[model samples]
Target: MRFCILGLVEVQDERSGLRVLPTGAKQRALLAALVVKAGHEISARRLIDELWGGHPPANAANALQIHVARLRRLLSGPAERDADQPERRPWIETTGHGYALRLSPAETDAARFQHLTDQGRRALLHDPGQAGELLGQALSLWRGPALQGSVLGDICADEATRLDEHRLAALEMRYDAYLRTGRHGEITGELVDLTLQHPTRERFYDLLMVALYRCGRQAEALAVYERARTRMRHELGVEPGPALRELMRRILHHDPALARTPGPRPADPSQPRATPAPADDAALSLGDEMARLHRRIERLQREQDQLLRCFRELTASAAQRDMSVNWEGS
Candidate 1:
């Protein structure tokens, strides 16, 4: 069985696929708190405090015990049975005054990700190339938002924030690697997405503009700066920082300094730019074509409206003539 905490909390038994925890919110909270603090024993009192936020009920301890029992049963259920032991087993083990999930540090994706990132950072001083690969590997562990569908209290919220910071650092480290290797074009789209997602992150915007300029898309690079400037003015009532302003100046002056510096001698010959996925390229192109089609449809509807108006006028005139002739005969 493996517990994944890099994103949402999930437990998977190789034999039985994925296991869904019982439905109670507090019950799930109890499990998530333990999972985040995995490998360490959490005191029963602390668990109660976390669940109830200090003003726990008189029966809070009893309630916690009940929740723990339920979680233990779920973990030890038939789905998690091991061949070595015919008896069902509980993954959570009890300490003198606390409980710990019986999981090796390696069994959790979150732990492994953090470990790899730490190693990468240390390796960076000696071998940036190897550090970049390790950081990239660490980043691939995240599937989505951490603890999705789970409500986080004060402590869990802090843990989530710390985890996110680590992920971002790993991403920046990877970007640095790409930059070092002169893979400027490859980082452009990613930097664009990152800047959009984290609009206030000035560094992302700077990196994006640099990447764009390096790829010889000077016009597009200037446009990106303009967009970032507009966004900052409107959203935050501020201007771009010194670093971004300097980048813009360099770009406008066509500074040779803006060009990608060749890496240490014996640089690999530049490879052809990889084609973007067909689905993504098609979606972008289809968006423009769809807009044109909509405009054409609107124009046709207007022409149809004019034809209908003229037909109505002709029908009224003919009806009036018939009525006038009938009146004259009478």
Candidate 2:
């Protein structure tokens, strides 16, 4: 059974699919705690404290064991339950510290989402189409809120919060890729929705302004900056950041650079990529110096060769003159 914590803390089976988990809130919370702390030992004390919130039962250890047992049983999918095969290893491992949920990165959607988000971020500038696709796949893993409907302890809540942040970052990155790939018209409406959903996230407003300008809605683009400025001033008592302000200035001045160009072209996978241009000024200067020195060395060699030829010609001419003088003497 695969543990999906990107959305709800649900289980998915390959053969039967979407197995129902125990209805008990604590049971789900225990499973969530283990999954969040997957592969790490969690002491019984910590688990009890988190589960009971300073009100652990007299038989806390036994209650915890019962929950672990139920979770172990839940891990066994219908295929495992129906199989006449030999007994498989348990999903929960008992450790000297306490217990650990036996899970790997591949077993959880959260890990996959993170992996894809990272890959997309790395590809954002060069291969934006592929980046958009990867980021989309990552975002798609989120069915709703992370660990949705599960009673969360501190560990689970922290993980959920982190994943939510990651999701928002991924959304911004994907939208950036979309804009870079000339999908501006398509994303403007969505950007508007995002601005409403996450009013404090300034990046969305920045992107929406750009998208609107590209779509030839210059007035709306400027109006977006006004809205952002008004919101920040009214709520946060600060002006928009330099990025938004700069964008506003450029849009107001009708900067020609804001006009849409074709998005980054998809690179061919079969072909080896050309070396990227040097990003550092020092590196570029060094490369140019090396090139200049090589050309100077070649020029100096040519001059030396020409001088040698001249010297040889002078010697030959002097020798011929001497021979003539000797012949005249003879």
Candidate 3:
């Protein structure tokens, strides 16, 4: 039997490869309570608290036992449907005080995800390619939010939150791996979704800005920084983090290091060598455009100065002519 908590609380029969989860609320709750702490034995009192909180039934212990029995029967695989031969061994074994669900690390998706992420993190510094592979595999296991369809108690809720955080960290790590390999264009869309999904996360915002800047969208990258700064200020009453701020500064100055990767060589040998390739062409066009705009602005400024001078000279000449006319009349 395999337990699944990545998406929902479920038990899948390995032999038949079919989900055989209990549908009742309390039964699922009991299973979840045990599955959350798979290896260790949870006391009956704690199980009661987790399942029913402070409002357990008069025969709460019996109810708990009944739920446990249902879970065990369901966990006994496909043979539980057969009346001829009942499976002797139960997944949930009764201890002296309460019970313990026997589950290997690979048996639960959550556990497996955690294990893969841990391995990925360890491999990150030494082998980013392997790290990305492992982290990608780890992230692929998540179908939705932790315990997607199940009602979470305090313990489960906390565990779910922890799991979600781990998932985010793994995602960021995987993205970082991609960034290291100069695959920023590929991850920009995904990073945009992540930033929208987690608006407060500066790391996502930073990655988005970097990706946009690397893709030659400097203005858009700066806009993203401004949005993040504004949101942080208006919502949290704080400035952006150091990393984001530094990236903004780099973008503002058009740091060459950000685009250190050389652009593709131009094709078409017959074409004039003057025209740059796509990436270099963008940078060259921006520089030439800025220079042309600067020249136009300077010329406009000179014309305006000349017009002001002409206006002043005409006004002076008219004043003198008025004075001469006034003197002749006097």
Against the true structure, what is each candidate's TM-score? 0.68, 0.75, 0.74
On lDDT, the leading prediction is: 2
TM-score of model number 1? 0.68
Q: Candidate 1 — worst ten consecutive residues by lDDT sum?
A: 273-282
lDDT of each: 0.74, 0.79, 0.77
Off by over 4 Å in 3: 78-88, 260-330
Q: What lDDT, from 0 to 1, does candidate 2 have? A: 0.79
Worst 10 residues of 2 by lDDT: 274-283
Which stretches of model 1 miss by more than 4 angstroms? 14-22, 54-58, 78-90, 119-132, 233-239, 268-330
Give the root-mean-square deviation of each candidate in angstroms. 14.2, 20.8, 13.8
For model 3, how does the per-residue alpha-carbon lDDT over 178-236 read when each residue is reduced to its tens digit? 76555777898999898888888999998888777778777667778778877888889
Clashes of each: 0, 0, 0
Model 3 misses residue 304 by how many Å? 35
Q: Considering every candidate listed, which one attains the maximal TM-score?
A: 2
What does candidate 2's lDDT look like per residue over 8-85, in tens digits? Answer: 677777566556566677888888888888889999888987688778899999999998888778776543664653
Which residues of candidate 2, in runs, are more than 4 Å off?
Answer: 77-88, 262-330
